[model samples]
Target: MLRDLAGAEWPRRAGLAALAAALGAENIRWVGGAVRDGLLGVAAHDVDCATTLRPEDVIAACKRAGLRTAPTGIEHGTVTVILKDGPVEVTTLRRDVATDGRRATIAFASDWSEDAARRDFTINALYAHPETLAIADYFGGLDDLREGRVRFIGDARQRIAEDHLRILRYYRFQTRFGAALDEAAETACADLAHTLKGLSRERIAAELLALLALPDPHPTIARMRERGVLGVILPEACPAQVAALARLIAAESAQGFAPDPIRRLAALLPPSPDVAETVAARLRLSKAQRTRLVNAAERTAHDSANAKALAYRLTPPLAIDRLLLEGADARGLDRWAVPQFPLKGGAIVARGVTAGPSVARLLQAVEARWVGEGFPQGERIEALLAEELAKRPQP
Candidate 1:
């Protein structure tokens, strides 16, 4: 499975050469998500190296090789080796000393299996040789990967007890790569969903964003709802809106729309500004994210006479978001083609109108007439503007 990954890239080689020379080649191996992604033919974003050497040993090797090093997590036996492209994280093998469902105290260990066992899931426990790419799987992650199963490393309850964040991670991995969750894992997550409140808002928000970004997350969301996890994370979550999300996904697919987490979140929430505001505040969303969600909800509520009116009143993104939420296609967004009002303040001034509120009022009146008349162009627009101004009582 790792044959294609054997020919290490320069970054991989550089990291390995620096470390293998200082700590024996037998002590270092590529570990964590990189191994799993490599076997799945997914481009590993960050290359992580695990070693039997202590954190200081890893740092010394990086310094001896003339590479920059940082103690990113030295207390947990991890160091960052800065390479040309990016820093690769290297962690010494460690066994858990204690866990409190949020953090784990660790003690460095020489046994690779102990480190592997301490991990959360079987697939994430797999390791690879930095030079030869030989897989070291002590947990049958290879079989799970082949079968598209997401299983915990050992006891599901024990893994969840180590870190409640894993509850979200389990669903995320299932949505991203795996087909389904093991029954025991599902039961454990459902029973422990309440613990998610103990997690930081940032962590919970990040996981939710990842889950919502999946190509099609309606089923995953439904599963989350069934497991009681969704309500725990988002008290205002509307599982009933999964149907709306399905329409959104279909519309996006047909029209080549990029997956948008904020927009999808709007669809998942009750289409009310109050609900949007509450979710935004609960998730601690950025100002921009909050504004977009709220605007989409507000804009989608108005009964636009047509797509043109909708686009002209709001923005294309807002209109499209609203359309999808209503189970309607955003077909004309790319071709919104809403011509300008064809009347500006200067034009109103040229009409012998004062530059005060009257000028603004007259211009707005003419623009409304033009829009009401279906955005007539050229001479007709000029004629219509003249008629509207003449009908206004002299001031």
Candidate 2:
């Protein structure tokens, strides 16, 4: 039971206890990730609460209870309250009045069934009565949870039509549930994948990142590919990425590792950093994430081209991403010495070379000569440079 769910986290429990004391059984429990994780024996990350109180009332009561409150998603009747113990997000029950596959216009609904019906998945529709621990499943979410099944809260197609992002979420839960996916859910996803065109690029990016961030992204992505969403979003990849991902997963399995989503995303890329960066931009990855993945992809491409070149081209984090990419590809990557590119723009500029493309070309030539000389001593570098400069035609 998740709706108004209490976590095993002691601070969370204390907050729930205080909430029950403050509301005196008026709280309808919560219905989100916390309950799902608790049921799965996984640690909960975020907790959400559902209540009979309107958003304003939730804000006021939170103030009375001495918790800081903020409008995080008030447009959708959600408010975030800062408990001395931890932050809690509470939202009022609501029913979707209309949806055009990108966004929903909702109306406040006092009935739990109406709220439950509006939920995207059955596993999300269950609720617990804080006082009784009595789980409510107007949509058989508990049964689905037990069956390791991910089912839509109502008609699968209707639920997906409410939010195109739910198409991605349906597959995300595939890795979470470890269950046989419901056929109806898959069909709905296929039916609604085209509707994702209506969704904002930023929203699509966040959803995609979240999906990629999951511990087991490959399987879910495989499902997405099977459903045609993958090709539409990323035409670069084939099943090779999945094979590479499996090797990465197998090698890391015993480490009990937590993954870096950005690096993992690079492993999913084709040989092109341009393509990866473009996809990152389309999803509106934070500038930092976009930069990180782009760098990671670049390092991977270079390392794939030449193991020795990688050390010269990439720094530590990017090098790590590069090796991981190779490992994911089931390619061997042994370390090699990487000589520095030994030419400086300032030094080249001081050599009677003006600051323009010529200087850049001179630097490239110097570096190429240094590499060609088997990375010889400084005098050897000077000799080659002098020889090249003397042979150059006047520009």
Candidate 3:
């Protein structure tokens, strides 16, 4: 049995206290990730609360308390209360009325245990009171949390049948917190891996990126492959690419770079821009994300000799991606800011070159020479320009 939330700082926020006072502190308790992470001693980023009060009543209470509230998910029994510090989600305790693996129809309930029962995982169903800071573990969530286990509540397959996204969530949680995979949950996820096809590509992409964003996702990713879940959503990422991902991770660590999900995703795919664009389209990635993915997929030698020139051509980030993918040193660009081309087309025209297509052609030639010569400036740029112009026929 978990005791009070001692080291948790979220319960002491003024906005939470004010809202609690307005809605009778006993009527509300911090629930879900906030409660789970608090007990784990991790700083909770978002605070979620469950209340006996209905959505409308919660909105009314917030308005009366002078706190702004938004109907973020009113149909599903949630209201966003904007506090001074940040927004805290306040939701009425709910029970699943119906579920179709994609979404659920929920009904308001006053029983905390009933609400906890409807949740997906035991660790996520834990709650903590506001006033006394007492934890309510309707399931063995406290024991599971202490054991670093992520088990689904009740029937694993049935819970997954309620929401197919849980399959990915299980892997993410397992990667983040679990010491060992729950055998039943793993089996259920493997069996229901095909159901992930029914989920929206956007949702699947979000979950996949979140999983890839973890510091060390190699083990979980291998487990996902073993369970046949990775192939369902990301068929482009072949088994051989798992080794590529491991190499990329090692390179990132060596370069003191943070874990980049998009770059990692690029590493998992073949070095073909066409394949990258196709996968990006299938996953519904944003335009910028798609471009980055394609850029990283381009088959190019990221030689250390031309590191600056590469950064100059394709921005530093893209250049770094290619360098890291090829296992080349990219630290030369750590503090180096790409310099602007010292001469423009106007400068070429000023040198008595015609202002038509010839001027543009001459500028390109000079810039190429400048880039090849390591972006020389001052007299060197003037010398390059004079040399290029001397080659051109006098007007």
What does the lDDT read for residue 138 in candidate 1? 98
Q: Could you give candidate 3's per-residue lDDT for residues 11-42 as a string of tens digits?
A: 77888888888888889988999888878888
- After best superposition, candidate 3 residue 286: deviation in angstroms? 0.9
220-269 in candidate 1: lDDT tens per residue?
A: 88888877899898766665676677777887888788889988888787
Mind sharing the TM-score for model 2?
0.77
- After superposition, which runs of candidate 2 have C-alpha atoms over 4 Å from their true positions? 1-7, 10-12, 251-257, 299-313, 328-395
User: Judged by TM-score relative to the true structure, which candidate is superior, 1 or 3?
Assistant: 3
- Which of the numbered candidates is closest to the native, going by highest TM-score? 3
lDDT of 2: 0.71
Residue 102, model 2: lDDT of: 77
Task: Summarize candidate 2's per-residue lDDT along 1-395 as a digit string, tens digits.
Answer: 32333344532467766766665565657566777666656677566788877898887776787767899999999988776567778888998888888778988889888888888888877676666656677877777887889988778887787788888788777777846868888887886788778778877766676777777777778778777887666656578875676656654453334566676667677657788778787777888777777876665343544443454545545555666666533123223445666657787667777889977877778777675556677677767667767767887
Q: What C-alpha lDDT do the candidate models reach, one value each?
A: 0.81, 0.71, 0.89
Clash pairs (backbone) in predicted model 1: none
Query: What TM-score does candidate 1 reach?
Result: 0.89
Give me the displacement of residue 333 in model 2, in angstroms.
13
Score residue 293 of candidate 2 by CA lDDT.
79
